[model samples]
Target: MYLKSIALVGFKSFGRKTELAFGSPIVAVVGPNGSGKSNVAEAFRFVLGEQSMKSMRSKRGEDLIWGGSPGLPRANRGAVRVVFDNADRLLDLDFKEVVIERVVYRDGQNEYLLNGTVVRLKDVIRLLAGANIGGSGYQIISQGEADRILNASPKERREMVEDALGLKLYQHKKAESERKLGETGVNIDKTKSLRRELAPHINFLRVQVEKIEKARELKEQLAAKLNEYLAREHAWISQEDARLSEEIRMHETELRKLSESVRAARGARGSSSDAALAGLQGKLAEREGKLAAARRESERLARELGRAEGALEANNVTVEAIVPVPHVRNFARELDATVSELERVDDIARVRSVLQDIRSRIKSFIEGLSGAAPVTNEEVKQQVKSLADSLARVREEETNLADELESLRKGIAEARESGFAAERDLVALEASVREAQSKLGGVRAARENIAEARRRFEEEVREGIALVGAAVHSWEKAEIPPGALSEERSVQEKRRRDIERLKIKIEESGSGSGEAVVKEFTQTKERDEFLAKELADLEASAASLKDIIAELEKTIDARFHEGLKLINEALKNFFTKLFGGGYVDIRFVASQEDTRIGGSLGRGARAYLYRTHFFDDAGESSALPRSRRDRRRAR
Candidate 1:
């Protein structure tokens, strides 16, 4: 690959766009001193990723850009491009012509481009390294720099030789590898320290994890026991509810029977009451018939008494004997009490018997309290006897009527009493029913409350079980708490308490270091493994660097020795021709001087000395610019 062309724009002295093509293998750039010829070389350096401003004849990025000559417009930035002819593809480029560019901004920023695509400075460096080209190497030599190698310090000289021998790439690789190795060592130390810090925490987490596992196991067992207890409790509650319902149904049935009986009694009374009352009234009318004949006898006696009033005044005649009632206050009170009791007693037989007793007492009382009277007039006695006989006849005919009327009265009274009793019983039965229903309602509310509480408890238990069981495949069939057969409420309560306690234990055991701890451990281990792998890779890179550096050393040695040998032969021929048969010799100033690495190890500058033998009839040594200053200038 050879440089084909170079383009410059706003670069140093080249303010406008400029292109220079180099088609021939050899091209000479000739110009007077200070005519911007050196700027071309600086441009090459700039494009090749040179960072040393002094070497580029500039102190800052702005110095590389055009700063407006007297008659030219000021430019803001600068760019330089070099094109390569890569017909053989030696530069590993697909294009026949490859372009590399570098741009400097007014600011300190700079950019590199390959074939118009923005790239990095290192990309340019690496590409040049492939072709044994460098920004300050043998590729671009100047007349003034011809003796640069001889003027260089021993260490710099050695570096020049290495660059010339195309070992710069290897050196760069070795340096980078060493840098990475150093960084890797630091990282390894940091990783070890991190592991040291985490070790105790991890161990603590391990203990916590063990406790958490135990807690989880306990929770699973508690949940299983709770499920069993809850199911049993539900069954018992259901049975109790059914029993209460059945009892309520029985009470309701009895209430219905009582209600029907009361209704029947009322209906019977309602149907027969008016008819019985009317029949008693007719019997009473018939029983009162003797009073009419007694009334006529009384009227006739009244007239006779009226006529005999005058005669009776002269003769105080005796009347028939009559009894008087007793005047005792207790008798009146007793009579009132009997009458009240009789009012209450709706039974016809009872009323009649009580009335007869009361009448006999009243009559006896009157007789005891008052004296008897006798009939005074003879006509009045005859009239009384006749009326009494008539009354007796009438009473005998209606005696059966009295019995019938009494029977009817008794039936009506019994019916009335039965009706009253039935009403009382109905009222009492309604009250009892209301009381029973109120009690039943309370029982139902309590039962429902219990049911709701049970449902919520069981749901919470199942939810807890599900949470624990999600982590355990065989959790459903796990063993539960002991002895929970018949006592459902106690069993469920125990399970609930156990669940709460287990949860507390779980919290106390450090829930933090459970699944997360496992994940962290796994991730940390992976990170450690990755670090180890990275360390190994860094070590391998260091080893490869060592091999490459050794190889570069060997290459420099072989190439330097071989090149010096060929140069010495060419020098001998040049000396013979320049001075015509002069015997000349060229050798290192010291044995170490011949070797760049070995010579640079010494204190003095690495150099070469020459001796000449002038042959003029007799073989003799002749001087040729023997001063050190002249020799250095020639070099």
Candidate 2:
């Protein structure tokens, strides 16, 4: 590769765009001082990816931009581009010509471009290193820095010689490999530390997962036991329920039949007799009331008749006019008939009307007596006769009422006797009914006990389902063992106890978090495995980097020593030719102190060159030769 052209824009004194074309192998810029000759050389460094501002004769990036003159404006940025003729492909690019550019802004930001495409400073450095070119190398010697190689320390001079010999690429690769190896070592330590930290948690999760798995097993056992227990219990309860229902139905039917028998017995006995006797007793009471009223009327009529007789006997004076005897007899007969009708009339209204008619007739007869002329003795006799006949008729009615009352008393006595017998039979029938009701109540109470048992059984089923999940419903298809009904309840109780024990164990094991614990365990274990794999990969990469670093170091050392020998041979010839018959020699001397390489302690040596010149048997004097003591004293 060779220099083609360089372009500068807003760079230092080149405020406007500037281009320099180098068509020959050697080119020189002859300018007076302060005419940008140094700036042009610095632009080459800038475009080649120099990082230090002080090396470019500037304090900061903005100082590298052109400061305005009186007639020109200041630049906001500085850019430099170098084009290389790469027809020989020495630059590691496919193109015949390669352009590399760098731009620095006033804010101290920098941009790099390769062939018009943006790139990083590291990319530019790497690409340039392949062609044995670098920003700070012996290839671009400044005007006053011609003797820098002779004045530089052994290490710095070694680096400059290495750059000139085109070993900078190997040096860069070795340095990068060492840096990556250090980072890989740090990453390995971190990965191991992480694994150490994760160890206890992973173990804890393993224990939890084991516990959950055991709980799952116990739950499975509990579920199976529940299926059998629930199914058997349900079967027994159903059987009991049906049996109790049938017994209840039988008891109810018996109770109903007993009740009907009691009713039939009551009907077959003196149920109507009791009603007839009650009616006859009521009529007897009415007849007794009528007898008392008739006796009173009879007494009243006897008094009235005696009063009429006494009036006739005392007066002895006859009325001139007399009522006809037949009429008087007819009145007496009518009064008697009214009293009889009163006795026959059951209604009070009819009896009252009859009594009122008798009173009106008596009143009219007395009024006629007062109005009669003296017919006298005959009319008094007839009135006396009529009053006596009325008394007699009333007395007859009282006697008839007494006779009817006696018959009603006899009928009532017979009805009472019959009612006693019927009541005894009713009491016996009621006792039987009561006995049947007592039996029915006992059966109903037993049925209630069965119902309560069924309720309790259902409650147990619900509890089982809650504990073991809805899978308990699978119990419906479970078979009850033959003759399980004959098994003692204690057997079921034992089964229940077993179920409860399993449930307690399952709860203690925390089955509820089984799935989550398993998932977390799996994930944690996977993370640990992945980390382990990554750690192994990092260690392998670190090992590979170390190997590469060791190889590169070997190559660099070999090449450096070879280049030093060539340079010494050329220097010897040049010294002989330039000074005519004086001899100069350059050779390597190893340093003593240990050096750190790739974050490790190791032996390190740099070639320290000293020049010795001799003239005709005089001992040689060393130029720039220092022992360890002198070197230390210089430090």
TM-scores of the candidates are 0.54, 0.64
Question: What is candidate 2's lDDT per residue for 488-554, written digit by digit as tens?
Answer: 9899889989988997887777658477779989998999999999999999998899889878878
Best by TM-score: 2
User: Which residue pairs come into collision in candidate 2?
Assistant: 318-374, 318-376, 319-373, 319-374, 319-375, 319-376, 320-373, 320-374, 320-375, 321-373
Off by over 4 Å in 1: 23-26, 186-223, 244-501, 510-635
Residue 192 lDDT, candidate 1, scale 0-100 = 67
For model 1, residues 18-79, the per-residue Cα lDDT tens digits are: 88889787888888988789899888888888899988888899999999978998799999
Worst 10 residues of 1 by lDDT: 318-327
User: Candidate 2: minimum summed lDDT over ten consecutive residues — where?
Assistant: 594-603
lDDT for each of the candidates?
Answer: 0.63, 0.79
RMSD of each: 15.3, 16.1
